[model samples]
Target: MTATLMTGTDLAAEMVAKAADRARALQERTGVQPCLATVLVGDDPASATYVRMKQNRSKKAGIGSRSVVLPAETTTEDLVAELTKLSEDPAVHGILLQHPVPAQIDERAAFEAIDPAKDVDGVTTRSFGAMAFGEPGFRSATPGGIMRLLEAYDVPIAGAHAVVIGRSPILGKPVGMLLLASNATVTYTHSRTTDLPAIVRTADIVVAAVGRANFLQGDWLKPGAVVVDAGYNEGNVGDVDFAAAAEVASLITPVPGGVGPMTIALLLEQAVDAAEAQTA
Candidate 1:
């Protein structure tokens, strides 16, 4: 049987529209506009484009966005200072430090600079702790988006065996935690994992986030497994080979049109939530 398509593009559009209305209502209720501050260092073209896309989406959602661009040589101390300023700004409701900052900078330090209340992207140590413990807090945008998509499609999570590849701080680790919180038995694997295919084949749900071009093949999937490809590599390829996976998976998400749209939409939605919470 051909796999059912789980397209995030249409879902994200619907989410953004609701977020826009929430933003408008928050501003009307408290005279406080939702504002997101995006920080980027070292002018990576892809990172710049991502930041710009977020800013554009924020505007369309009726939320305000501020961008902080730093030179490639920016020091860790300086980057932290910049993020700190945004964190303390009462008007700024959310803080997002674009990942892969300059090599010399301490990315973790910069991420920690944002206050927990404004950590809408959910990249802070505090946010991770909250997720691990199943506490209420902002979730990392990508993982949160994946969960939303799963819920929207009514993919059964409770008691399902979920195999999550990759162990990155925000993406893999937290996503696995989220699935576990939803009662899915989670098995997290990485590059060093031996017999990766064997592990993946046992999963009823799969989240491919290895960050390589078509690294996870389609045939490794268990027939009728629900697949979420969270990887977007060069040439518009995802971690899982979409063509091959679609033929086998009971449900599959496509590259570019899948997880990509959901990330920004969730970010905007969380920003509105932060604004409303902070004002209250």
Candidate 2:
């Protein structure tokens, strides 16, 4: 049977509309417009595009946007100092640091400098820990989006075997933790994983988070497995061979319209939540 597509575009739009309503209400009650601060370092064209898109979306949702662009050679200390300033800003409710900052900057240290309460993008260590333990806190945007997609589509998560094909701290590891919290058995694999295809075949759900394009083959999936492609490589390609996997899997997510929109939606929603909490 051909797989049914799990399109996230419509669902993401619905979520954004709701967030806009909340943002409007918050502003009316407290005269505090929810605002999201985005930090970008260097001139990576792709990263810049992502930041611009997020900022545009935030404006449409009634959330204010602050753009902070840093030079490529910026040192770790300077980055930390800037983030600390945003964290202390009462007007800024959420802070997001575009990933893959300059190599010289300590990415983890910069992430730590973001206060946990304002970590709307959920890159800080405290956010990660809270998510892993199923505590109430902001979730890494993409993983949080993935879980929302699964729930919206009524994908059975509990008691299922989920194989996450990557080990990146933000995407792969955290998604696995979320699945585990949902009662799904999780197996994490990375580039070093041997017999990768065999492991994937055993999963009831497969999450393709590895950054490579078309890295997962159709033959690697079980006949009815659900596929969630979280990779957006060059040329809008995904980690899974979409055409091939669709022929075997029961459900699949497309690269651009799938996980990407949901991620931005969740980030904006969490930003509104942060604004309400901080004001209350």
Error of 2 at 261 (Å): 0.3
**Candidate 1 runs further than 4 Å off:** none
Query: Per-model C-alpha lDDT, please?
Result: 0.93, 0.96
List, residue by residue over 1-280, the lDDT tens digit for candidate 2.
Answer: 4999998999999999999999999999999999999999999999999999999999999999999999999999999999999999998999999999989999999999999999998888898998899999999999999999999999999999999999888899889999999999999999999999999999999999999999999999999999999999999999999999999999999988999999999999999999999999
Query: How many clashes in candidate 2?
Result: 0
Which pairs in model 2 have colliding backbones? none
* Reference-based lDDT, residue 261, model 1: 92
RMSD of each: 0.9, 0.7
Deviation from native of the Cα of residue 165 in model 1, angstroms: 0.6
Indicate the residue-level lDDT of 2 in model 2: 99
Give the lowest summed-lDDT range of ten residues in model 2. Answer: 122-131
